[model samples]
Target: PASTQRHVKSINKRASGQAFEVILKPLSPVSDAAHSLPSPPKRDISLDDIQKKLEAAEERRRSQEAQVLRALAEKREHERDVLMKAMEENSNFSKMAEEKLQLKMDQIKENRDAHLAAMIERLPNFHGPSTSLHPTPSFSPALTLSRADTRPWRPRGGGPHRHITPPHTIMLTTAISIISGYKHG
Candidate 1:
């Protein structure tokens, strides 16, 4: 029985690197059991041999394309994960800051309310009419108004419609001052 074989020819370059025509012709197959020859035996390069080589090159090209696409998809997924993690961290920070601000505001309100209550309770005991008329054993600036602070000034309305209540003795000084300035500076 005989066997058919396919072969490819390698191009040889001249030592001078000159271009030459390659004329292709049909070649006969050599028997494997023959005596050693000085030169390599040539074999036929048929349609099947060409098709097999082209198919091998195409296969390599397709495999490389698939590998590149897979790598790109993995990179995109990693970027999305990193972005989501950063957004989550920012959201947590904002929530913590808002809670801290709310706590500070509540503390301020409570302190203000407590201070106001204490001031209201102490007002009457400290502001009697006698406190204004007589000097204490020690000079206390807080309980007494200076002569400048006691000076009279025009009330809010400045005209006929000023807030005058009644003939009460407590308001006699205020009524006289308002009437004195009704028609002049």
Candidate 2:
């Protein structure tokens, strides 16, 4: 009965310890050691042939890189040319606008002078206004300063009214009352 108890205690100790056994074995696909070596290449292939193919591939890759760089440079150059052209056009347009304004001012002066001269000629005793306001047929320092007709506009250089003026200017009106001696109601 003691022997039977001892056998039960041994079985319990083994179950708690949990020891395991292992067995090494080769794979079924590679059972033969001789089959593991790789096969040799045919006699027709050589190191020179492989080297030539590698060099050709390298040359092709270099040519592709060069083409990409050339395309990028061309794109940059085209953009620069477009920007320069736009700036030139803007400068020309501004110059033309300034010339137009000067021409308009000169035209106004001409019309006012012609009208005033005609009205004053009709009167026997017509006194002219101050030289600063209007210029007469005679030459004066004030007339010379305001005169634009004598100095013609040159596109290359030496343009009339080079300075900027107000877009809206006050123009004098012809006063018929001064010439006719008539009173306003």
Candidate 3:
């Protein structure tokens, strides 16, 4: 019985020593490790530092804006150059067209003048009664033969005769007669 009691006491003391060792080992390592690690670096942030950073950011933004404005100005200048070039081309085309029109008008005027000169050259002068005539006095012409003569005469030549009967004149006379008859009716 004495030997049994001694064995139990020895077992209890071994268990207590193991528990104490487990607790003390973990605590000492944790505390020592915490103390050995360096503390985090101190940061003394000031309002001046924040203001300087903000100013730097603002300067960068301003520079970007300036670059954008310069690019826009260059683009506008290029566009203006293109527009001016197009305007110049249009003006040149217009000038060419005007010149062509003027040339055509000049050619038309020259042709008309030449035709008039030819017509004048072919026509006979009628200042006096010595010109050719048919000598027939019974035609009862509508226009006077001359300013001095009371007899009327018909044109004899074929070149644009002044006394030629117009087709419209017959139509006009018929229309007038019909209108007069309708009015009487």
Candidate 4:
């Protein structure tokens, strides 16, 4: 051991005079231990450790993919629900509009009927001799048409074709025309 240990010489200088100094120092213990000790055995990586890490990474990837799929499904569901709600609202609006139109149409029909009845009730007020021009015409009015004196005629140069429509016929025609015109209008 003594032979294996290494030594070095040292020198010193004084201001008074230059002196020769003999000193022997052995090698430091840290240097000897560095050479004597073997490096720690290299850590061995097992196949199971690498496989476990890969499996964990794959699991994490699958989990992330699942989350993305779930989010997409939820988004589609929300969109579908919104579309259905809009459609329902549109349907309700259409129904309400149709009902309102129908109600207005019914009111118009009632008003037309009332006006027609009022016109029909006023027919008897027309002036006619023995032909009152009532809603229910009497046979006397028809007889008045054929009578010699009541026969309608317009003297045109005293010709044979001087016969014209009777007063009662004219009144009846006016009433009919009024009814037909009201209906059409």
lDDT of every model, 2 decimals: 0.58, 0.57, 0.56, 0.69
lDDT of 1: 0.58
> Model 1 compared with the native: what TM-score?
0.46
Per-model TM-score versus the true fold: 0.46, 0.39, 0.47, 0.51
Could you give the candidate ranking by TM-score, starting with the highest? 4, 3, 1, 2
Evaluation by lDDT, superior candidate among 1 and 3: 1
Model 1: per-residue Cα lDDT over 1-185, one tens digit each = 12344444556778999756555444445543365567877888999999999999999999999999999999999999999999999999999999999999999979865754454344332332233333342223323334554444434655765444333222333332332343132
Encode model 4's per-residue lDDT on 1-185: one tens digit a residue.
87466554556678877867565656777778888877799988899999999999999999999999999999999999999999999999999999999999999989977875765565544333232343234323453344564656676677677668765567655655666565455
Error (Å) of candidate 1 at residue 165 is 25
Which regions of candidate 3 deviate over 4 angstroms?
A: 1-42, 126-185
lDDT (Cα, tens digit) per residue for candidate 3, span 1-185: 43233222222346456522222222345567877878899999999999999999999999999999999999999999999999999999999999999999999979865754554344233122122233123211223123434323345555553554444334433433433343354
Cα lDDT for residue 71, model 4? Answer: 100
Colliding residue pairs in candidate 3: none
Candidate 4: which stretches are off by over 4 Å? Answer: 1-42, 125-185
Per-residue error at 73 for model 4, in Å?
0.7
Model 1: residue 57 alpha-carbon error in angstroms: 1.3
Q: Which candidate, 1 or 3, has the higher TM-score?
A: 3
- In terms of lDDT, the best-performing candidate is 4
* Candidate 4: pairs in clash: none
